[model samples]
Target: MKRALLATTLCALPMAAAAEGELNLYVWSDSIDPALIAKFEAEAGVKVNVDGYNSNEDLLTKLQAGASGYDIVTPSQHFLKIMADQGLLEDIDAHALAAFQQVDPKWRGQWWDEANDYSIPLAYGTAGFTVNRNHYKGPVDSWKVLFEPEADLQGKIAMLSYPDEIIGAAQLYLGVPFCSEDPAEMKRVYDLLAAQKPFVAAYTSDNIENRIAGGEVAAHFWWDGNSMKIRFNDNAPIEYAMPKEGLVGWLDSMVVPKGAPNVENAKKFIDFMSRIENATAQYNFYGHSAPVAIDTATAKYTAENAPELFPTVKVEFSRSCSPAAQDLVTKVWTQLLQ
Candidate 1:
C-alpha cells in the first residue's frame, strides 16, 4: 500500500548524493525501499540512485537503446538470460562473492546465469489475481473469477499494464504452454482476452494496492508479495488466488550491467544486500520471498498470515520467447487494449 513517485525514465531520478562513490540502480517500480537504499549509503558511503521500469520489456528496451548508466539492474530470471545474451550485463563473479554462500541452496545454480556468474538472486514470487472477499461470496480458487467473473466482479477487474504475465496466465487457463509459437494457440489467447475486455475496469500497473484497497476495482492481476502487503499492512479483506491452472514463477536478481558507471560500488551494494540482516529488511519492506536466509519472527509476514507467498499449485516460470512468439504476444496485448 506504499505510494512512490518513481517514473519510467532514467531522467526522472537524480544522480546520487555527494558521497565518495555512488551506485545507480534501475529496477522494477516500488521493488526497493528507500530506507534500505539510505542504509546502504550510510554503511558503504556510496550513494544509491534508482530509476524504475514497469515491465521486463521496458528494461530490455532501455538497455537495447543504450541506456548504460545503471550500475546494477534487477531483472527477472527469464529476462536475465535475454539481457545477457545481448551482452548488456556484466560478469561480476557473483558466485565467488562471499555472500553467495548465504544464498538458499534452492535458489542457486539457476539457469538464468551459469553458476551465478552474472547475477545475484534477490526476491522471488508468483503472479496471480486478488479478489476483495467482501464483494464476492463465492469460491475463489480459479482464474475464472477474473476471466469469467461472477456478477459481483463484472466491470470491476483490473489487469497489469504489462503483458508478460497476463499472457502467461491466459496460456495456463487455455492449457497452452508458455512461449507457444503456434499461431492457432495464440489466437485462442487473443480471443479469450478480447472476450474479457468489456469486464476490465482498467489496464494498469501503477498504484495497484491503492486501486484494489480503495475499492476502485474489486479484483486485480497482481503479485503475491504486493497482495499480502495490502492484506497485512492495510488489513484489507483480499485473497490472492492460486488458480487451479497454475501460477507464473518469477525471480528478480541483482545484476551489474555492461558498461556500468560504478563497478566497485555495485559490488559493495551486492555484498551489503546479501547480508542476512539487510536481506531481512528487504523482505519485510517488499513482502516478497527472499533467496537468502532471514529471521522469520523478525520479518513482517508469515505463512500463516500471507499464504499466497507459498503456493501449492505448479508455478511455470516464463522463458525468453522467440522473435515470432514475442511478437504475437505483443500483438495480442496491443490489440486487446485497443
Candidate 2:
C-alpha cells in the first residue's frame, strides 16, 4: 500500500495536478531569505514553510528517528552521500528539470551528485576565520593568525561550538589530511585546537556576526558569505581570510526526503529558485556563490569589493569518510570540547 501511494505521487510529480501546496524546506539558519520564499509563493500559488537545522548531523538524526513532513533539506556536499546511502533522499531525477541546464558547468558532475539524480546545488562557499581589522593590524592572510595569534590576540578569539567546519579548519591549518583513519594524524589536529583553547574567548555559534562586529572578539571562525554581509552591510571592519594553508569548501543543496509531504511542490520550489531573478536576489541577500549563475545585470552585489568570496588559495571540499575515519573526527572533537 505504501509503495503504491509513493508511485502515485511520483507519477503526478511532473503533471500540474500537484502544484499548489506547501514546500517544507529544512535548511541552515538565516538561509533562503523569506522575501524570496514569498516571491515563489506568489508565482506558483503555493505556500511555503521553512525550518532551520543546526548541522548536517542534526538533519540526519531527525530523519533517522522517523520524523516526517519535510519536503526538502539543505545538506552540505559531503553529507549528501551519507543521506543518499541511507535512503533518506528521494530520487528527484534532477537532471530532468529544465533549469538543470543552467547550472554552472563547473558545479555539474560534482563529487556529491555526479549524475544529478537527486539534488540541486544552491550556494557554495569556504569556511574560514574572520578578523576585526581594528583589533588586529597584522597580516590576515593565513590560519597562523587564527591558531597562533599575537600575544595581544590571546583570549580574543572565538570558535563555533560544533566540529563540522572548525575541525576541518584545524586540520587545514596543521597540514593534516582530512578523514585520517590514523589516530596519530587525528591527534595532531586535536592538539592544535586544544592548545588554542586558552586564546579562544568563546565557543558558541549563536550570534557570531554580532559578536564579531560588537568588538567582543578579535577573531572568530565564520563562513565567507556571512562575513561579507557583516562587513559590507553592517559596516564592520572585518576581513574574511583566504588562509595560505587553504580552507574547507562546501555546497549546500536542495534534496527531497524519502517521505515528503509535498514532493511536487518541492520540485516546483527548486525550479523557481533556479530562475535568474530569484537566484540573483538570494545571492545578493546571502552573499554566497551559487551553483547556478545569476543574472549579473539584475545583481545588486558582486565579489569585486568582497575579496572573501573570491579566494586566492585552494579550497578542498570535504568528503564522507569511512565509519572509522568519522569516529576519529568525532573523538578528537569530543575530547577537545571536554
lDDT agreement with native, every candidate: 0.85, 0.84
Name the regions of candidate 1 deviating beyond 4 angstroms: 1-18
Candidate 2: worst-modelled 10 consecutive residues by lDDT: 1-10
- Error in Å for residue 312 of model 2: 1.0
Best by lDDT: 1
Measured on C-alpha atoms, candidate 1 has an lDDT of 0.85
Per-residue alpha-carbon lDDT of model 2 for 138-227, expressed as tens digits? 887888888888897899999998887888888888888887898998988888888988899999988888889887998999999899
TM-score, every prediction: 0.93, 0.92
Candidate 1 C-alpha RMSD relative to the actual structure: 3.4
